[model samples]
Target: MKILLIILFFVNASTVNAKTFSVTNLANSATSEDCLDYCVDGVCFWLVCGWGCSVKTTPHINHNLPDFVVSSYNEPGENSFSEVQSLDVMKNIQGGNLTTNSKSKRANSGLKFKEASVTGNPVAYAMGQAKYLCNSKIKPYMPYYLSTLDEKMWRSGLSDMLYLSTWVPGMNEVSSNKNQTDEFLKSWGSLYPRSGFLNQKNEVKTASVIAARALEVVSDGGARIYQSSGCTSADCMKKNGKWQMISPVEENSCRAFGIESVEELKDKVDEDGQYGWTAWRNYGCCIPGPGAFIGSSITGCLN
Candidate 1:
C-alpha cells in the first residue's frame, strides 16, 4: 500500500503539469502511391476506406475522377498560404432532401450536427462521430477512426484543431447513444477488419499502416487520404506530391498564406485558405516546395 500510494502520488503530480491527448495511430510521412492496392468496387473498402478518404481529403488535386461515391475535383489553386476547399455548394441535390428539405443544405450554415447519435444513419460518417471537450465546453467531433482521414489530409490539423479547440477537442466523454454507436460500429467493422477485410468485396494488404480512413465530410468525395509508414512505390511522388509550404500570403495580411492549419483550411471560406496555419513550427517542420520561399515576392500561386 505504501509503494502503491507513492506511485499514484507521482503520477498525479505529473498529470498536473501536462495533459494526455489521444491521437490517431498514423505515422508522419505518408505518400500517394499507397492507393494502388485498395482501388476496387463493391468491396467499398477501397471506397469505404481509401478512395473515399482520398476524395474528401484532397479536393484541390483531381487529375482523375471516380465513377461513384466521390468525383475527382480540385478547387483552383490559390496564391495564399492556405488552400481552401470550396465547392459549388450545389444549388440542389439530385434526389435527396438536400434540395427538398432546404434545411440540410444550409442548416446552421452547415456548421452543426444535431447529435448523429440520435438522428443519423447508424452507418457511414454518422458512425464513429463524437462530441469533444475544449476548455470548459463540450462540442461535436469526428472520432479518431474518422478523424484518421483528417490526419492523412493535413499535417498539423489534429494539433491545430486541438489548439483552436473551439470546444474541447476530445471524444465522447459521455454519450447515451451506445446502442446506435454499436450498430454503427458493427457496420463499419464489417467493412474494415482487424487486419484484412472480412467482406469479400475487398481484399486489403496492410503494408505499413495499422489503420486507414476516407474523409467523407470534406471535399464532397474525391480521393482517399490515409496514414501509413511512408511511401510504398519507388515512384511515390508520381501521383500524390509532398505538402509544400509557403509564407505570408500578403505583405501585411493577418492570415499569412501557405498551408492553413487543417481547421482553418478545412472550414475556411476563401480561395487560398491553405495559407493560415496557426503554428509555423510549434509541433514539427512546416514543409517544403508548395509554400516555401525564404524571401521571394509573389512570383506565382503559392510561394
Candidate 2:
C-alpha cells in the first residue's frame, strides 16, 4: 500500500508541474501557415501526448477570393489575438458550420469556403491541421496529417483530407456519433496501421509520404469528401506511370504504417486485443489554407 501510494503521488506531482504551451495568431499580423507551423512544430506534442491547438480565421477570411500564397509576419499588438476558448465555436469550425451558415459567414467575413492547397508540402499540411486542434484545446493522441487534391476539373472538394490512425477501435463505441463514424470507419478501414508516409515511389515510406500520396489522390480525384462510402479507382493518383488507388482497409485491420507490422500493434492493443477512442475528438484539417487568410503585412510568432 505504501509503495503504490508513493507512485501515485509522484505521478500526480509530475502532471501538476507539466508546462502548458500556447500558440498565438495576431490579427492581420500572422499568416495561417504561421499559426499552423507553431502548433505543429512547437506545442502539438510533449514527448508523445498532443496538446490541442486552434486558429482565429476571422482576420484572414475576406469578401474577395481565397489567398493561396504563404508569407511571414513581424509581431502583433496587445488586443490582436482572436480568442476561441469556447468548445461550441471549436465544434462549429470542425463541422464546417461556421463558414457555411449564411449569418455566421457574413458576420465572420474573412472566412471563405475552400480547401488547403494541394500543391504544398504534405508535412506542412499535417502541421497546419495539428495547429488548429492545438489552439482549439483538443488533445491529440495519435498523430494526424492533412492534404488537398486540387484538380482543375473538381471545383468543390471530393474529400476534405485523409486521416491516418495509430490505433484501431475494435467493436467498441469510441465516439458519441459512433453510428456515422463507424459507418465511415467500417467502409474505410478503422486502423491505418502505418504511422509514416510513403515516398513517390512508395519504396521509401514516411509519414509525409503517406500524407502526400493520400492528399494527391483525394485532392485531384475529388473522391467523396469526408465520406467512408467506397470510392472507385478513378480517384487514384498516378504512381510513376500507373494509377495507384488502394481499396478501403479491412475492418480491424490493425496494421501499422512504417516498418511496424500488425503483430506489433497487436502487442500494444489493450488486454481484450481491442482498441477504442480515448482522447480523440471530432476534429478536421482541411480547406482555408493560410493563403485564404493572408492580407498585406502580417506579424505573429511562427516560432
Candidate 3:
C-alpha cells in the first residue's frame, strides 16, 4: 500500500549515513533459559463435522526464545547488531547531537539518555529440533526498527508526555522495592514517554531500561505477541512478554521487568557502554489435528 511505502522510505532515509558495530556474540549468548519451563499443559480437540471428534494432549511450553536483541548505547548508529545498525542512524537528523554522558544538561538533573535499537536475533533458530515443542511469533532476522522512523518521539519523549500515565504517581515506573518503602532499592527508570531516556545512574540498568522501552514500542506497533499459554493461536492470550539478559552478563533465566537487580551479575559493567537482552515469549502447541478444530480442554494450564 502507499502508506507502507511512505513509512519504509523514511526509515531508509533516516539511517542513510549510520555505521554498524558488532558487539555481542549471538551463539555464545545462548543460555539454559531457552527452555525455561516445558510441560504438558492441556489438550486440543479436532472434529470432522458429522464424522467424529478426537482430543490430543497439548504442551504448555515456556520458551525463552531470543525474539529480538535490543541494544542500548551512548553513541548513535553504534547498535550492538551489525546487520541492523543502519536502522539507528540519527546523526544527520534533528536533535542528533544529544548523546548520553555524565555532563549533559539532562544528566545534571539526574537523567541520562541513550540510543536504543531492536533487531531480530540471528541465533533465534539455534534450538533446531527442540523448537518443535512450541511456536514462535517472530522469525529470525525480522527487523522492527522503530527508532529509525520515530526519532522525534524517541529522542524528545513527546509521545508519552501527552499520556495520563506519565503524570500518574507510581503508575509507569521500573523499580525494585523488596519491602513496601518510600525509597526503592533500585530504580531502573520510568516507562513514560517510552523513549530512549531514563533516570537510572547505573550503566547496566540504564541499558536495560532503554531496551525495555524499545521492545514495548515495537510490540505496540503490531509485532506478533508471544503465545505463552496453552492456546492454538497467540490471539487467545495476553500481549505481555519478558526479557533475559544476554550481554554484559548472560543469564540462563528470563524474568519480567523490575523482577531482579542487575547488580547480582558478577561483572555487570561493560566498558563500551553497550548491552543486549533476549526478548522471551511463551507459546503453547499440540499435535496437528486430523480434521476441523472443534473444541478441547486442557489440564494444569499455565497462564
Ordered from best to worst lDDT, the candidate numbers read: 3, 2, 1
Per-model TM against the reference: 0.15, 0.17, 0.70
Candidate 1, residue 288: how far the Cα is off, in Å:
24
**lDDT, model 1:** 0.18
In model 2, what is the error at residue 30, expressed in angstroms?
Answer: 25
lDDT of 3 at 121: 60
Scored by lDDT, the top model is 3
Q: For residues 1-303, write the lDDT of model 1, one tens digit per residue.
A: 532333233334322111111111000101112211112111111112344332111111111100001111111221111111122122222111111122333322321110000001111111112111001111112121122223232222232233222133222111112354543332212111111111211101010011111111221212323222122322222111121111211111122122233354333222211121110100101112222233222222221
TM-score of 1: 0.15
Better of 2 and 3 by lDDT: 3
Clashes of 3: 3
Report the C-alpha lDDT of model 2 over 175-283, residue by residue, as the tens digit: 1234645534432222132211111211112112333333334323434232221223222221211111111111212111232343533333221111111111112
Summing lDDT over every window of 10 consecutive residues in candidate 1, give the lowest-scoring window.
21-30
For each candidate in the order shown, give its overall lDDT on alpha carbons. 0.18, 0.22, 0.55
Off-target runs (Cα >4 Å) in candidate 2 are 1-259, 277-303
- Candidate 1 error regions (>4 Å): 1-107, 110-275, 280-303
Give the per-residue lDDT of model 3 (tens digit) for 87-135: 5675565333444444555433446666777666645544422434454
